[model samples]
Target: MSERASVPKEAEETESEPEQEPVTTGAQSVIRALENAGTDYVFGVQGGAIMPVYDALYDSDINHVTMAHEQGASHAADAYGVVTGDPGVCFATSGPGATNLVTGIADANMDSDPVIALTGQVPTEFVGNDAFQETDTVGITQPITKESYFAADSDTVGDDVSEAFALADAGRQGPTLVDLPKDVTQGETEVEPGRPETPETYEVPEEADDEDVQEAVEALAEADRPVILSGGGVIKANASSALREFAKEYEIPVITTMPGIGSFPEDHELSLEWAGMHGTGYANMAISNTDCMLAIGTRFDDRLTGGVDSFAPDAEVIHVDIDPAEISKNVYADYPLIGDARNVLRQLFDAMPRAPDADEWRDQCQTWKDEYPMDYDTPDDEPLKPQYVVEQFSEMTPDDTIVCTGVGQHQMWASQFWEYTEPRTWVSSHGLGTMGYGVPAAIGAKLAAPDQEVVCFDGDGSFLMTVQGLSVAVREQLDITYVVLNNEAVGMVRQWQDGFYEGRRMASEYPWIPQFDKLAEAFGARGFTLESYDNVEETIQEARDYDGPSVIDAHIDPGENVFPMVPSGGDNGLFALNEDQLDMI
Candidate 1:
């Protein structure tokens, strides 16, 4: 053969037979886009339809954390976003897998946490044919997600991820869904040269209007007893520094919501140090007595407001939130500012004169502080109290420690009891009240804030839901403290049965929970039991001093119910088990 012909054939053979740099697949394109967006980790369960994304993750640089359930993965992603101020990613497939994620997506929507959800769909041709493992995921999640879309080809996968991230991190951040058809997973594509095409613009957080700022400042200046009610929005809007300055400059007192734990440092003189279902007596009393209240980033949940009529009735309300819909939704605000709390404070500080009653208002708030301080009498009885364990745990950890808790009595107790002195110090899924959230979320929180001490305040009932994750911490060798408030029952259910359901004693009773200390030991974690009230503090100190993950099980009274709970339809001071009703019970 001629030399030229041989050269051409040899080159063709080399191209066709020999290996070269791997060509990009649809899944690779998607993963590359995720990496570009700065995704630190992805939470998901392995599934057939979505395996391509999982496979891509192996080659790319993104970290994947396996979860027992898709719902847990979604919740963990949302919680991670809340703590880090960045969007978190979760993956699942179509049909049951996608359907299972509805609750979590809705929970993120309700609380406005930024989460990006990726799901697989049936092949393009079979989309409407109702093929196996096929469900209309886009339609199903449209109502729940901030934005929803499905891509049929590999070329569009990158665009979908970029869009999902943008929607999640945009103003009033919420969950977003981008579903991919399985056929697209195998297709090849060359990404068009440059960066991912972000949406035309992201929703810049709502800024404070001049008029509202003036009005809010005027109210603060005119009031003799001004109070600042800090909520989750303060932290969400990144307004903690502004809030701190305003509180100090005006000498106004501060109260925080359960989710707003650390926005105002607990050590600050004006800080409420109140939390969750059971807040401090002084916090509640001050709410009713203050002449003016500046409510920021709070939803005014039933637990926070008690009865609508009695909540801050005596005070002139100044509500500020980024979401206009949240304005006047619950408590009627006398002066509602439909803008960002942080921005409004910024504008108010510049335009209005700073009030001069710092000493007087500070003195009155201190009086309430002395009256109903967060003091739990150390009972002489031998059995350990969870309250003592929580207090001691807070003392041992630094002020910036991150506390994540499971749902039920222990969650509310921790919210009411622990002193969170820094923004994002406490994390949980508040709206859905998912049981297994604490342990996995603590893992995610540690990932987000590696410098801070992470603790999980879990109840016996809730801890059992995701006890498998105890192994997760050990395998990763993460430094976290798990404090199990063991009351030996589904305490919240029992409370309702005992109080509202006429003590019928339904399925809420769990006579046997496997030995928790042994369970921890098996997971390669240090475990101990607090047998007496005398040992509670010392035991917690030991748990803190341990080198790795540890668990402290306190034998709290099975009968100790969360108090000051608002009955199904009752208002403030009209609860089934309140401070006033404690003596009678």
Candidate 2:
């Protein structure tokens, strides 16, 4: 669990008492339902339509962090959910406030992160009259949420929220929303909601079928070059320990998807890091060469598999997932074991008779790692390398420090260079590739794990999109380090324009971008700048030493590009190390 939700001692002691229920408004009932669920914190912005709920919150115990924007609130809640297994909660008013949460909701849906969004609606009578600050929020969000609710009655509003909360953290966890109308919230209600529970139709598979497990074990027993592929699902299911034990017992090498970066310690002898576009070359090589692949908790998205037909061409795949619909949806699963990751891995471990003899295969993998090392040159005269900065931070922080990033070259560099030793320590936007996620995510991670150090790596363009988040960090007195790899442009887009679009950079460059360090200072947070390697160590140390929020605007080489590239729809086995190699291919 991220942060364990706990009821008050007074409530726990009075659990068996049957006192008379007090008369309460629907808004008060809503707050009562959250109290029942033991919600620790909620991130949201106040608005006119949601005043009733806010008024009720005035006396409630839940810690509500007021964000600068609805989008930031949603992102913060999303990150909170990512860190903890429980669903993070957020609120927004009708119309624009509700609509602003769309990106974060869509992001959570795509990444399968658990979050609950409560959106206020116009009064029921005025809902369809094109009333001010009203929109068909349910209609707009239905496709993005695991489930959505339109609360029409004051008597059942609390129950509606309870059900929505249950569904958000239930099977294949994702975002769920509750649309509360003003009239319903303002109405009177005496009944309180019961404990949260999913509807009867919902069922979670605990373990795979016996026949499927037997078949998978037989395949593994007969394999020569076997590999274990771990995805974000492993982290979500809290099955990293089971996965590690299974891999080690079977003497199989492990590769991770980007979102699965922290599932296995990157420094482990058997670890090949992650595989996909811009993934480590050794990991991609292992994925291509394996004869039998045991993949767990992954949907095998296109970015990870590249060309579906070519991905793991020589491997007979045994895919394990809780959601049956995802089985064989992308890469064909030779053996489909449908169940929870931890349970299924436990079954596989018990059923397997002996480990495979892949000594030669393991040696070959080590050779590949040596052949394509993740190294870069740093001449003293050249501008600061982003990779060096990432490595420096990685070396400076503890192994368990939480890292967040925005989508761009900086994100890739952070993921590639950092050595992750624990699960839930790597937080970022994946699947949806949402930019401007670093700042708010860092704030949420700090709240989720108050003792752990939190750091965010962002690019200039991405940082500019959500710089307003700095004010919230300062206000909260959160200890977080924000590192911006300012390349004077949208680095990733510019890199792509240079490589794939005949070098015609259109609106990707931002030469007039403001200095982020000064901007952080203006927001009442500590700030520092890095022009070269001369001050890299001292600058980073000063930022880390600060007791409150800080930003390091480290200007980097504009010409630097992310390599180990697999052009869209290309085979993962044939990734290039540079643009020149890409052109030659």
Candidate 3:
């Protein structure tokens, strides 16, 4: 009997027993939280402190785009936020990696873009000891973030992350952060994370007070000349269509802030384009002279208001915003309507007694547009004008193409020349004005909307700041056209120096620059050089037609400057169209 019955009882027990669940770590719970929130993509730079989280990401279905630098990852996430109207997620390790994300976080805060940043911290025990790669991420980012948290325990780390994710997209929508200690993330945990949800204390205003809406409507109705100043918040709230309908029904002219470029169709009859320093002359004039201004989601930053005393001097301002804090922070709001843009607009439409008599005002706005047209000259003898390149590309691409830009003269040119007809099509660092945003932003925009074509306009110095982003695009095989307006200098700084610093071009101009096209080729992308008109169309077409990333080194006039400028503290109506006209201020 002993020889015949050799089978172990353990084997039979194992076969009959149910399979046990795999052990879940704190890091796995964090990933599960994001998955529970339906996150499809994450942009990040890997480091030792965050290794556990990266390991967790391995088995998850979320697509993680590894970037060459933490700064690029942050910008990419910011752009993703702009395009999707969701909280774009970014990851970084402690110390330098976390510090690198500061600029992007600040940018998102200023622009009111939704972004979630997950930063790794040194083990909880080593936090104050200055351990390797240690950083006080929560402390550093608190001012810039809508809310920042330190994950104190492994059991609640996932909820901390989930809360951050929800908070980033709630209320006025800004950046949020969660600092995960290494030990906390490595600790064992089996608690499953629930769906992302903001705390009960968090509440967004759905509509404006009825009395305030009525007052705003009355002011607009009584206005002889009313202009609607649409800001980035309109697009962020997905209120573009509502804004358009309201403006059309009332026959009021629409003026966009730089970040509001795509909130209203640029070519529409009531469109005044954008208004600010270096904005369209007509838009600025309209903002300056309006008798009543209905400012939607605009904070009336110094750039937009110029000399506050002179901006809309005769106008009674009706400010509509989701965040009440912004109602009268910069500009006095005669009528404050605090609510979501779309909801408020709908309320205004329903409450209006009748449409205002704005036909005459509309005619006046049209007159301004005809008088101050956005046109640039391109003499065959001179080097190519970047504006021409922008215009040509705009004409060649579909209207839905997404345009991204770095901060500089090229950015102003792209904003000035490209006609945006839809929301979420123009992605740029509006509030922070980050120099190296273009290449990385294009990558993000393309990823966010894979079906839409993407174009990045960057200047030589600006492009040089984060050109490594091109490597990410190349590696990912993203379809994007990067047009570098190589002027061999920090064009904006040079222009400012030339105009205000007695022409002493101190650190602004660069004598030598790498041919960006060749650099693109080195990065395994299609490259083209546009030194003359002979290859302008051919080069751009070929670059746009390329299936993967492409860079065009389009040599532009070194002396070119962004005009229609309102000198700091100058009147918006008195924008300088050229360097010679600057004296008027």
* TM-score of each model, in listed order: 0.90, 0.97, 0.96
Computed on alpha carbons, the lDDT of every model, listed in order, comes to 0.77, 0.90, 0.89
Off by over 4 Å in 1: 1-23, 192-198, 356-361, 545-547, 566-570, 573-585
Q: Report model 2's TM-score to 2 decimal places.
A: 0.97
Clashing pairs in 1: none
Q: TM-score for candidate 3, please give it.
A: 0.96
Q: Considering every candidate listed, which one attains the maximal TM-score?
A: 2
Best lDDT goes to which candidate? 2
Weakest lDDT window of 10 consecutive positions for candidate 3? 1-10
For model 1, where is the 10-residue window of minimal lDDT?
1-10
Give the per-residue lDDT digits (tens) of candidate 2, residues 203-306: 98889999989999999989999999999999888899999999988889999999898898899999999999999999999999999999999999998999
Q: For model 3, what is the error of residue 401's alpha carbon versus the real structure, in angstroms, after optimal superposition?
A: 0.4
